[model samples]
Target: MQTVKYFTQDELASLFKAIKKKKSKYWLRDYCIFRVAYRCALRASEVGLLTVAEYNAQRSELYCNRLKNSQNNTIRLDDETKKALEKYIRDYGIDDCLFPSQVSKPISRQTLDLLMRKYCKVAKISDKKKWHFHSLKHSVAVHLADSGLDVKELQHYLGHKNVNSTLVYFQFTTRQQDNMYKKLEQRNYLV
Candidate 1:
């Protein structure tokens, strides 16, 4: 079984904190971008393609345009993401792209990778080379699976074209195995 690389909740919190401490003009935009990417389980390219119009403020929803033949879906925004997005939109007066470069183009995937590396370094996350922008998607998928989301549901949430694509996350981490053992113990299955 192949192990998926992902950020733990603690690491994600630390990363966001590091991003917040940065004094750059794009700080809020970067913060919101990462937050949304994690929450929506979006690929870096998908995130780059995001547009301001895709955010439905009144409905508190974001329409994700999935790539690589994945199904596209609209995800409801969490309170933190919603608030951050609203503030970013208001502060930046963004008209088109959700994350635009100075040249008025969508931020490139390479730029996203660089930003991830920069923030991971600032957060002092060990094995920083293992954590790329795609880790946000894997992190959310793993976290959601560990939270007891069903495979079908997780598949839909991730916009996986096939359940097999989502099944990799069910490989049972050590934490998940421990949980199973605890559940069996509570049922006296070992007896």
Candidate 2:
């Protein structure tokens, strides 16, 4: 399996901008898919498996079944994500399946991959990279680390049985030693 690297903040912002351009309906779906994937840190299957009802309307929380593990997860919704999901649900009426097919069935993994490829093409990102499903999990992990979340907190958020699983994400975002600098380098001013 290829390793997925973390994107710099600016790079991520640029990709978001790329997906937001006035392109086609496909781009809209692409944007929604990418944003949901990156923001929620869900596996591709989880994203495709989601249903409109997975969103708790009253609490504004989103739910998904953890992939590879039998755990269940519910997280507070992001505004942009909520908007995208709401739009998709309203437009498609896939109350039973958050991701849908024209035949009124759950979206297949292959279809999800195709959607991913289309977006990556427009954004000029690498499709060969292992940045598909769980890569989003890595992205979220980096984001949380950047936000100063502790490893313990992340362990719980990620639903990891062990804290070591969360460490991999930190490793992904860790800068080279040369890139590290002391904040205390400022001129001495004991004011």
Candidate 3:
């Protein structure tokens, strides 16, 4: 099986910085979409289908209707994601689709793919070909897993119907294995 690829937190930060340097008017919208995807661990199609109506600003939550498995997930919005989305909505006067085309329609999957490529190029992400838009979702899962989130909870968070789907992401590499051991030792859990 091909190993799943994921970004480290520093790489994610670099991507956002690269997006910020773009001169396009859609930078805010793009950044908001990227942030929401990473934070919510959304699929590209799910992110494309997202509309402003899904966001409950008062509750700081998003009602995500994922396209692949027809899963309806209620995701809690972090303050950073909430603020970025709120500002994008306000600044762009976006009252309909969150990421809209010039024709005022939801951006297509192709467009989302192209956008990821563009930003990844700007960020100078290594071996970009091996990574896809779904890597953001993997990144969230792996990062949260490394931070000690229970696999069961991570499964629910990723909206995976099967626990095995979530388990694949935790198949650690040698460096990750070492890191996990070090973390356990620091917590005195090695005994």
Candidate 4:
């Protein structure tokens, strides 16, 4: 099986920090886009297809429209992500599209990919080719799996149509295995 490329939590923090340092006019928008993408495990196209109507500010819920025949789901937003979405919506005066381009349409997937590349470069992440926008999805998946989320739950969270697709993330890395072993030892499971 091919290895999945993803950012470590530290790398994600670095990426966000680098994005904030730019202080560009669209910095908030860019940051929110990446944050939402990672938090929701959304594909670039799914991010582009997001609509304001799909977000419920009062409930802090987001309706994710999955692609590639994946199951669509409505997920509750985390406090931080909820705040960011509220601020982005209020500040941008968004009426329809969640992340609109200058043309008032949803931003294109290519633009998202380009923005990811730009931020990855600013973050000084090596192997730029491996850290495309989709890496956000993989990063979140791995992070969630590492956090002890059940595989079935993760499958639903990722909107995977097949468990096999979700099972790929269950292949833990060496560091993850070490962490698990340490946890087991701490709990005296090895005794």
Candidate 5:
């Protein structure tokens, strides 16, 4: 039973603001966790299970070993997300786990799921169940498509097994397809 939700940029920002107000370092913790999902389109379990060594600050790339998607991918980190991760690492201390327990144990996937629910509740967010932790990843892929990234480019970023999977990541209308086919037809002198 998995619920899926998409976060608009505004919604993502709102959640960040709500979580950042806390006095403890947990907010930073949650923020980095959020960025990984929102930016990389990684599954909740993949983000939670990530080890610290996977981050390459100089390259501005984040390596997420995905199980659900069954492929490991290197996600490019935008500046804002990179900064947030830097702060998280500085405050949380860089050990093995990016988000670790008090005893330095990696947080379980279930723990992150529960925490996100609590965060959503505090902010009075609705459709809360719809935006389960995995939606963050979905939002990222959708955003990439919305931003005009070509299907092949998005395919690699998402670590999808085939180009067909990338097709599902984007929303297409019949008119758009007809227009493209018409344009292709126009290119031939057979008109």
Candidate 6:
């Protein structure tokens, strides 16, 4: 099976920059969506259906009612994500949905996908073959794993029902694999 794809920090920054230049009315909302998804490792449906009531600023946790399964997850937000969400909430007013649609309801999964595609095009991001809305979630998992977060903890953080799902990110990247081999060679473990 092909490895899952993820966006690096540079690529995420590029996409954010492209989105900022649009001056669209929904820019703030979109920014919030992207930031929350990246930081929280949420699926598109979770991101789309996020509500203001689910965010507990004092706790810095956003509750995600998992769409794929009934088990819910409470995702911790980083300072950056908290700041962005605060700004968006202030500007948009916290009423029902965090990211309401034209009808003032939660955005649908299809609309979220379309918005992601539009931003990807605007950013001129190549390698569309591997990148998609779900890449943001993969990026979060990969980044956390690279930072030495225990695999079990990452599985819980990503709200994966099965540990096998989380194991994919633990499968080291090329650079990490090379480093591991070098260490083993230096330790004379390799014959």
Q: Tens digits of per-residue lDDT for model 6 on 1-191?
A: 55888888788898888878887998988888888988888888887678889999999999987766535789889898899899889988767788888898778778877888899888888878534778888888888888777778888888888888888897854555776799999999989
Q: Write the per-residue lDDT of candidate 2 for residues 1-191, one digit (tens) a residue.
A: 23456555665666677778836655566677777767666766777777777788667687767776635667777888778767767775556776666576776777776665555566677644633545557778777876767778777677676776777766554442223333333434323
Tell me, by TM-score, which candidate is best. Answer: 1
What TM-scores do the predictions have? 0.92, 0.77, 0.86, 0.90, 0.81, 0.88
Pairs clashing within candidate 3:
none
Local accuracy of candidate 5 as per-residue lDDT tens digits, 10-56? 77676777777654557778778877777887777777677779889
Name the regions of candidate 6 deviating beyond 4 angstroms.
172-187
> CA lDDT of each candidate?
0.90, 0.66, 0.83, 0.89, 0.74, 0.83
Off by over 4 Å in 3: 173-191
Alpha carbon lDDT of residue 67, candidate 2? 74
Please write out the lDDT profile of model 3 over residues 8-105, one tens digit for every residue: 88889988898889958788888888889988899888886888899999999988877656457889998988998999899889888888877888
Which of 5 and 6 is ahead in lDDT? 6
lDDT tens digits, residue span 1-191, model 1: 87788888899999999999996889999999999999999999998789999999999999999999999999999999999999999999997999987688998889899999999999989976546999999989999888888889999999999999998987844566778899999999988
Against the true structure, candidate 5 reaches a TM-score of 0.81
lDDT-best of 3 and 4:
4
Rank the candidate models, highest TM-score first.
1, 4, 6, 3, 5, 2
User: Highest lDDT among the candidates is held by which one?
Assistant: 1
Q: Mark the 10 consecutive residues where model 5 has the least summed lDDT.
A: 170-179
Q: Model 4: residues >4 Å from true position, as ranges? A: 173-191
- Model 2: colliding residue pairs: 50-98
Which of 4 and 5 is the better model by TM-score?
A: 4
